[model samples]
Target: ERFRQVIWPGNSTTVPKGWEIPTNGKKLIVGVPMKKGFFDFVEVKRRSINNAETILSGYSIDVFEAALKKLPYSVIPKYVYLKSPVNYD
Candidate 1:
């Protein structure tokens, strides 16, 4: 049920306004805090993800790394591959 709500958010996959997560729930909650990821395709929604894999993109990554170095590492998105569009969707 949770998987259907996120990850593949097509039409009808939505959350109502002003709702909050349960504080005392026993079930595991995998949280992805990307605000863009919640509403649309995370790729098209976030240009930074595309820029990360392109030429001359290291500078941005460096700044982010420098700021977060003290924090623990988490699963992060890396822009490794890019494909041009053949036809507009």
Candidate 2:
């Protein structure tokens, strides 16, 4: 019963705004910091000789991927490498 509501959310007015899924085909972008130290937490590597291919791995990434797998809907994520000295503020 609950699954039906998720698949076909009737009465769009009753549903709260801001939770709508994007219709356009776009993958979610995830920014991962490129750290000089602490590679265990998160590590970004380039496999190709020309540095065209990139790989992301580590404990943090593993946990994130696990969580994504549990979600009811599919969420494609593109991990981008963020240079060090990232400023949140």
After superposition on all C-alphas, the RMSD of every candidate to the true structure, in Å, is 15.3, 7.0
Model 1 C-alpha lDDT per residue in residues 34-72, reported as the tens digit of each score: 322223323322347555432323344455546655444
lDDT of 1 at 1: 38
lDDT tens readout by residue for model 2, 38-81: 89998999999999999888999999999987876777788877
TM-score, prediction 2: 0.72
Top-TM-score structure, candidate number: 2
TM-score, one value per model: 0.21, 0.72
Q: What is the lDDT of residue 31 in candidate 1?
A: 23
Output the TM-score of candidate 1: 0.21
Model 2 stretches with alpha carbons more than 4 Å out = 1-12, 16-22, 86-89
Clashing pairs in 2: none
